[model samples]
Target: MPGMPKPIRLLSSQLVDQIAAGEVVERPASVAKELIENSLDAGARRIEIDLEQGGVKLLRIRDDGHGIPVEELALALARHATSKIGGLADLEAVASLGFRGEALPSIASVSRLTLTSRAAGAERAWQVRVDGEGRVGEPQPAAHPTGTTVEVRDLFFNVPARRKFLRTEKTELGHLEQVVQRMALVRPDVALRLTHAGRGLLDLPAAADPPGIERRLEALLGAAFLEHALRLDAAAVGLRLHGWLVRPAFSRSQADRQFFFVNGRAVRDRLVTHAVRQAFQDVLHQARHPAYLLYLELPAGLVDVNVHPAKHEVRFREGRQVHDFIFRTLQRRLAEGGLAGTEAEPGAPSPTIDQRPLVGGAPPPAGTPRQAAMPLRLGDERAGYRFSFAAQRPPAARADAAPPPVAEESTAEGGALPPLGLAIGQLSGIYVLAQAEDGLVIVDMHAAHERIGYERLKAAWAAGRVTSQPLLVPVVVAVSAAEVALVETHQALLQGLGLAVDPLGRDRVAVRAIPALLQGADAERLLRDLLADLAVHGDAGRIAAEIDRVLATLACHRAVRAHHRLGLEEMNALLRDMERTARADQCNHGRPTWVRLTQQDLDRLFSRGR
Candidate 1:
C-alpha cells in the first residue's frame, strides 16, 4: 500500500479555470489591468473605472467601445473564446493588448462577474451573469448605452486562500493606482478616469500634440523630471525608440521612476535594463538609477509576447541588436550634448562655445579672446605632475613651454564670450571661478582635468593606439569550463581591448599580455572579472569597462592636484578644454566638475528679490 501509485486524472473545467486564474489574476490591480487593456483593444476612446474597498468588494469599468451582440454575450464568458486571434499565424503576430481570451473565464472562476453591452445599432442592451462556480446565465434585456460595462464584485469570494493574500485597503489601492497610471501614460489619445469609494482620484483628458504630452508628463512624473529630461527619438532598421531621459545629475536612488513600454504594453526586459545601465554607467553615481520613460516599437512578429500569462515580459528575436542599438543611441546623444547642453537651468539659455581653435593657430580677427596654449603630457612615467594634451595640441609644442599672452575681450560693447566665460580667479587653489553673461561659473580644477584626460585616454584606446605589454612569463589562471569557452569565443574581442587570453586547458586560461597603460596591474584578477562579465552579458563591455576603470584611476592620479596653483591663463585653458570634452559635467567617479549660479539665485541669496 505504501508503494502504490495514484491514478492520473483530468482536472474539471471549473478547476482548470481557477488554476489559470492563479496566474492571470494575482490581485485587484491585475483585474484592473486586464479589463483596461480589453477596453483599449475594443477601440475605446473614453473609459471610466470605479472601485470600492480597494476593488476587493466592487470593481466596475465602463467604456465607450463597440460591444458584443446579444447572440455572442453567452459565448464571451466561455473558456477559450476570443475574437482577437484565429489561428497559429495570428498568435505569432499579436498586436492587440490581450488575446488569450482566458481573462474573462479565469476571472469568472474566482469572483462574481456581470457583463452588459449594447451593439452600435441594437434596439436594446443585453446582460449576462456568471459566478465563481462556473455557472453562466442566459442573456437578458438591459438598459445601457452603445458600449460595454463589466462589473466584478466580491473578488476571490470562493477562493478564501487567495482572498486572504490581498493586502490592506490602502496598499491595494496604491497598486491599483499604479496600474491605471501605466495605462494612462501609454495611450495619450485615450481619456481615462478613476474613482475610488466615490472619491475622484484621477481624470486625464486625451492629449493630441507634443505640448499636451508634455503637460501629461509633468502631471504624472512631476515638473523636476521633465525639467532635467532630454527628448530622444531615434530609428534604425525596423526598430524605433523614443522617450525622455533624465540627466545623470538628477538620477534617483530607486528605480521607481523608470517606465518602459514595448508596442503599447508595459513590460520588464533584462536586455533593455542591461543596455540602459551600460549607457549610464560612466556618468551616474554608484547605486543611483537613471530615470526615464522609454517606448520601443518593432514589428510584432519579431517579438514573442505570449511567453507569460501576465504578458509583462517579452522575448526579442534579435536581443543583441536591440541592446547595441539602445546603448549606441544613448551614448551618442550624451556625447553630443556634453555638459552645457543638458546641465543648463530650465529657463536659462544654453551656453555656446566659440568654434575657433584653442591651440597653435593664427590670431583671431581683432577683438575676440585670445586662446591660450597649454599642453598637458600624460605618458606612462609622468603619473606625478606633468599632464599632456598631445592629442589636442600640435606635436611641435613642448609640455613645459609657457602659454601665450591673454588678450582680454571686452564684454561691454560687442565682443563674443564662450559659454563658460573667462576664468576670473582661483578659490583655495581648488575651484576656478569664472564670470559668464548671465551668472557665475565655478569649476573644480582637479575633477575637470581628470575628466578631460580620461576622455582622451578612452579615445586613444578606442582608436587602437593603446599598445599591449607582453609578460615575461604567461600567467596561468584556473577557471570554469564556461569561462574557458568564453575566452576562446571572445579571443578577437579581447585582443582588441589589449587583453590577450587563450584557453590553456578545459578549465583554465593563460593571459600573455595586458594593456601597456595598465602594465603593473594584476592580470589574473582582471581576466577573472572580465570572464564573469562576459558570462552574464555575453559581450566585450565588461573587459572594456575594466580597462576604463584602470585608465580612470591613472588619470585621477596624474591630474592636477587640488592644491596646485595656476594663473588665469592656465585656468582659462582648462575651462575651454572642458567645453569641448564629452561628459564633462561629471568626472570619472561621477562627481560634478562644475556648477553655475544664476543672477537670480545670487539675488535670492542676498535678499534683493524680496
Candidate 2:
C-alpha cells in the first residue's frame, strides 16, 4: 500500500474556477466589491449599481468609463487574464484598483453573468455571456451607449451550499451598502447611484471642490459628523495623509463611521488602526470608537498589493516608518483640533498611574495634594438650581510646588474673554461654573482633571523607552502553525517590545521574557493579543502603543475624581490648562468635558428673546 501510486489529475476548468470563486466571492457584497473596483479602475465618472433581493437575485453594475472592446470581451471571462498588468514591472506598482483577472470568471462560475460593452467611438455595442459551468458564448451585437454593464443574476445558482449560506435580504443589503459607502467615501469626485428592489437607496452627486465634498459628506455620514469634523492634511517621508475626523464629542459606540484608505484603496490595515487608536487613546472615552474618513498615499513600489486575492489587504515594506508617521500625524491633528470626539491625534504627555481605591490613575494614594471636586445638580431648587459657593478655597497641593501654571485672562473689570471665559466659582463638588462673554460655562471637574492627568501620562511614556523583564520560568503557549512562523520571523519585533519568544513545537512558542511593565499581566493572553496585533500590523510598532495604554490606566487612577472639593483658583488653573492643552474637550473615555452656553442660548432657554 505504501508503494501504490495515486494518479495526479488536473482539476476541470469549471472546478478550478469554482475553487477560485470561493476565495473571491464569499458573499453578495464580495461580488459587488470586485465589480465596483473594476468600474473604478476603468475610470468611470458615473456608476450605477442596482440590486434585487439583496443582490442574490440580481446585481447590475453600469459604468460610463471606457468600455471594454468587443475583441477583449470574451478574453475578459478567461481565467488569469487582465489588461491592467502586462509585465512584472506593472504588477509591482499596480495603481489600478482591479488587476487580477479572477473577478469575472469567479463570479461567472457561481452565477449567470452577461457583460455588454460599447467602446468609445464604436458604432455598436457587443455582449458576451458566461454560464455557471464556465462556458463562454460568442459575442453578439447589442444596443448600448458608450459604456459597459455587468449583470449578474442568481448568484451561487449551481452551488446550493454556498447559496444556503446567504443571509436575510436586509443583512446582505447592509453588507453591500457598506462596500458602496467605502467606495463613495474615497471617490468623492465620482457620482454614484444605488438602487435596491427597484427603489433608489442612495444617490451621490459628484463633488469637485472642498465645500462640495463637505456637502457630500453631510449627505452620507450625517450632519453631526460634518459639524464636528476637523480637517487634517499633512505629508512626510514619502507619505501623505489627509481627511476629516469628527471631534471626540461625536464619536459613536461602535466603529461604524471609521474609514481609512491607502492610495485610493480602502483597507482595514491594523497599522493604521493602531496608530489612530494610540493617537486618540488618552482623549477617547473607553469603549467608544472615533468617526473619520481619511486617506494615506505613498509610492506604489513601497507596498505590495498582490498579497491577497481580493486585494482587501496590503503589505508595507516600511511598516514601522509608516506606522509612526500615521500615529504622529493623527496625534498632532487631534491635539491641535482641541476637541477630538473622533478625529484622530496623539495627546500631550501625562502620567497615567494605577489608583485602584479611587479612579484608574491619580496622584499618590493618601498623602498627596487633595483638591476636593465639586458638581452642580441639573435641577436643584436651592440656589436657583445651582450649588451655593461656600467661601472659595483652593485645593491643597504640595507646598514645594508652584501653583498650576497660569496666564491671566480675567479681572474684576468684567470684560469679554476667551472661549472657556474666566473661572467664577465652584458649584457643588463636581462642576466648575465659569462666566463667558455670552452666557455660562459648565465644566465636569472630574472629566477635565482626568484628561489633564491622562495627557501628562502619555507624555511621560512617549518620552521614555520601554523596559522589558526576563521571565524566570519561560511561559509556553499554543498557537497556529502560521503564528509559529510569524514568531520566528518577527523575533526582533518581540525584542523591541521587551519580549523574548522562541518557537517551541510546530504550533507553539515559549515566552522567555515580557515588557517589564507588563509583568503580572496575563502573559498568555497578552502574548496572544500581541501576536494577533502583529499579524495585522506586520511589525507596525506595537510595543510603544501597548505601553501607552498602560500609561492610560495609570492616568485614569491618578486624575482628579468627582466629589473632591476644588477652590476658585484650582478651578481657574484647570480652565487655563484646558485652553492650552491638546484634546481638552474630552476625557480619556472620549466624552466631552465641558459645554458652553452663549448668552443667546441662555435667552432662548427662557423665551427672553420673544
Q: Which candidate is the best by lDDT?
A: 1
Q: In model 1, what lDDT does residue 306 have?
A: 96
RMSD of 2: 10.1
TM-score for each model: 0.84, 0.77
Best by TM-score: 1
Which parts of model 1 have CA positions greater than 4 angstroms off? 1-3, 338-416, 469-480, 518-525, 600-610
TM-score of 2: 0.77
lDDT per residue for candidate 2 within 1-610, as digits (tens), equals 4897979999999999999999999998999999999999888999999999999999999999889999999999999999999999999988999898999999999999999999998989999999778889999999998889999999999999999999999999999999999999899889999999889999999987766776787688765555556667778999998887666655677898899998999888766787898777666766878878889999999888898888888988898899889889887767755322222244311111111111221222332211111121112122211222344333565432323323344433334354465676556567787776556777888888877787777676557776778888989899999999888888876777778889998988998888887678777877888778778766534455567677667777887877676666677678766766676767767777776665665666677848
- What do the candidate models score in CA lDDT, each in turn? 0.79, 0.76
lDDT (Cα, tens digit) per residue for candidate 1, span 1-610: 4987989999999999999999999999999999999999988999999999999999999998988899998888888899999999999999999999999899999999999999889999999999679999988999999889999999999999999999999999999999999998899889999999999999889987766777777677766566556656778989988787766655777898889999999999988998998988777776888888889999999889998999999999888898888888787655544343333334322223221211222322322221111122112122122222222223453433323224444242245445666766677778888777656777889999998999888887787765899999999999999888888888888888788888877988899999887788889988888887788778867667767787788889889998676766688789778877887766876666776665665666677846
